[model samples]
Target: MDTSSTPRSAVVLGAGIAGLAMARVLHDFFDAVVLVEPHPLPADDRPRGGVPQAHHIHGLTARGLDLMEELFPGLDRELEDAGTPRLDHGRDVLTCFPTGNAPRVDTDLGSRLSSRALMEARIRGRVLALPNVEPRTGLRVTGLVTDAARSAVRAVATDDGGTVPGDLVVDTTGRFSRLPRRLADAGFPTPPTRTIDAGVGYASGLFEAPDQSWLALIQPTVCPDRTRGAYIGKLEGSRWMVTLVGACGDHPPADQEGFRAFADRLDNPVVAAFLAEARPVSPLHRYVRTENHRTDYHRMPAWPDRFLVAGDAVCAFNPLYGQGIGVALEQALLLRSLLAARTGRSTPSGPVGVAGVAELTGLAREFQRRLPRTTGYAWRMSTFQDAIWARHRAGRTTRRDRAVTWYLDRLYRAAAADPATAATFARVFQRAAPPTALLGPRVLLRILRGG
Candidate 1:
């Protein structure tokens, strides 16, 4: 299965952040990479047909920014040159967690906040610059083409009956991917799935803000009785992106008055006051696809040899946690590491690392198995609060739920009173440290002492 002579080819589905990142990594490992997209991509930072939430606020977590910089060198500088300032999480940003306003002690955790389209454009430009990569836009992936044995994906069939053949295929087609149906059609077992539907909805819009120095003012919806929240973040082009969010079937109205009313419902009056005076730059865009869904591909007894799934196609989390981009970048980095280790490449690029189609079987399975572990903490962090809110509304709470609720309540109080505990909280929230770090003996003692 050595791919020493003939160059290895790869077909990556979708042209969103995940797809672009995957294609970039594959370009380093394969001889040729073909990125297929269903929509015609614009050259500028404009919303495309595929991403409905493009106008919404998107934060590149500290970890996500680091990974982006690693993948495309000088990306941080490029963003800064474009007038995107990196704000310190504690010093420059105001965060109102569910437990009330988080303590704003200066810390190293921070990220560059920008509209999704702008960030995507920068990454997309870098990805397309790779000589080994080519993008196929305006082509829908119908299904996967397998070899005679039907065990490995040999090519991807497009909507027009054309097939793009490749040595390997990766699916980054986002949440609405047809991969499950395609796999079932190929006589392969579909993966097990789990979902926690928060029933959250939001209305996002752009506004002209005089202030352009800070990052964001976030007030997330608290649990129990509170169901409304707001986020006002600095976007490119000297505009502000304001989003009013509600969960558990409470949707922000798309109309101007309704949007203002929703913003007013937030605990903080700052958002509503600002919206009252700030000039609206865009119509209120409503989005309702906020659910935590995960497909356990690792549990499948059999997997296609040359096929794999990443990003939202595998695990889509609630947007409130701001972990989507971070998780996607981490997944791409993981894919690169797996390929490099398998190919024995000193670095990501050089000679083709994969030996043959047979080798892909193990790599695909291993990747799927390891992918769940990467997203477990993030998934838990998102679903836990949503579950608490859901159960609070239903008036049905289990012992475990009460225990978790009690522990978190005390933890948040401790974080507000103690700087060290607050830093630990920020570390975990930024994904620099594991969640277990917050549950340690010292943190528990701090909570017991009523910090």
Candidate 2:
């Protein structure tokens, strides 16, 4: 490694949202940044072979939209130009609470709804246009190149018969990353991992929308006997992305007729109506691997100095909550800030370079600290809800369970009638506001007043 180089070199593994965003941020500090992906990059909005979830619906929450705007200025306009639908979360979405049917409240917080492929394609285009960023598709990283002491990653060995050397390496390989095992093989201890499985499954299908600009309806079901939920959203090109989800023992079937029956069972008639009117553009895509998994690599006593993991590789959450893209964007911003702090103070070759290493380690630790709080909250909430539903299905209910369910019924009814309460729920959904906000005095008053 030549410290005298005018700018640093960075290698980012995986060409997903996290990898692309990290490469964009790395370009600010490093002279060159390389992004490696396994599949051939798509030249248009067509799906790539890499991301299996591209067929599923993806929602950019209000908070995620804000983060995306900061990362890529004018991204909203770009998405709009590309036919992505902009939705007012409270206004456009008619949310049906489990307790009872109430008049839907129209609030103002907005979210952008689009196909995962379209959103990724837009971001990938901008990232590839960066002068210092190069995207190399169809090349897979087989192993890490380490020094004689095997203490630091000197480069990465790829299937393409070449070594891509850099000052740092980041693994953004999603949930299937082998970086942790690779690091352990290279002499580091295996990192601590935690996983919570709720046995949730997803079935998604694409259809042509009846209207061009109307927001898609999302109906969340809480069948104590079934523990199922469904979501529908409008995607680019006037297409509807509908996903039917189930937790615990209630699973959506992969067969077309069975999936339609599941959608018809939803508390709301909108999903069934849309399915009847719209023709399926693709086969029913099913995914049953939804689990909350996280690795504490930064907590390791002796992690490789030049390597770190980000995105789903660090923490993968249940996609039902739609936190994947938002978390990836936040990780990219954090990485950018850490690198900027290092570059602002000293040249790449100056001093011991110890300070840069320390800064990077601290950034990794900060991310690890936040990981549990983010993923754990969703994991607990989902599992707890699912457990309650399971018990209800089994015909066993304690007094405490009955009381809690009653309170939640009241809260949902209040949320539908009160704008302030609805906003609080929206914030929590977006991960922009803490769960404590739901307990605020104003919201409590509404719940008490029978709103």
User: Which one is best on TM-score?
Assistant: 1
Q: Give per-model TM-scores.
A: 0.94, 0.87
Cα shift from native, residue 270, model 1 (Å) = 2.7
lDDT of 1: 0.81
Cα miss at 105, model 2 (Å)? 3.9
lDDT of each: 0.81, 0.74
Off by over 4 Å in 2: 101-106, 212-214, 221-223, 345-407, 445-451
Q: Write candidate 1's Cα lDDT for 307-402 as tens digits.
A: 889999999988878888888888988988888777766486642535654546578878888998778878988898888766766778678878
Q: What local lDDT score does residue 22 receive in model 2, on the 0 to 100 scale?
A: 83
The prediction achieving the highest lDDT against the true structure is: 1
Query: Cα RMSD to native, each candidate?
Result: 2.2, 4.0
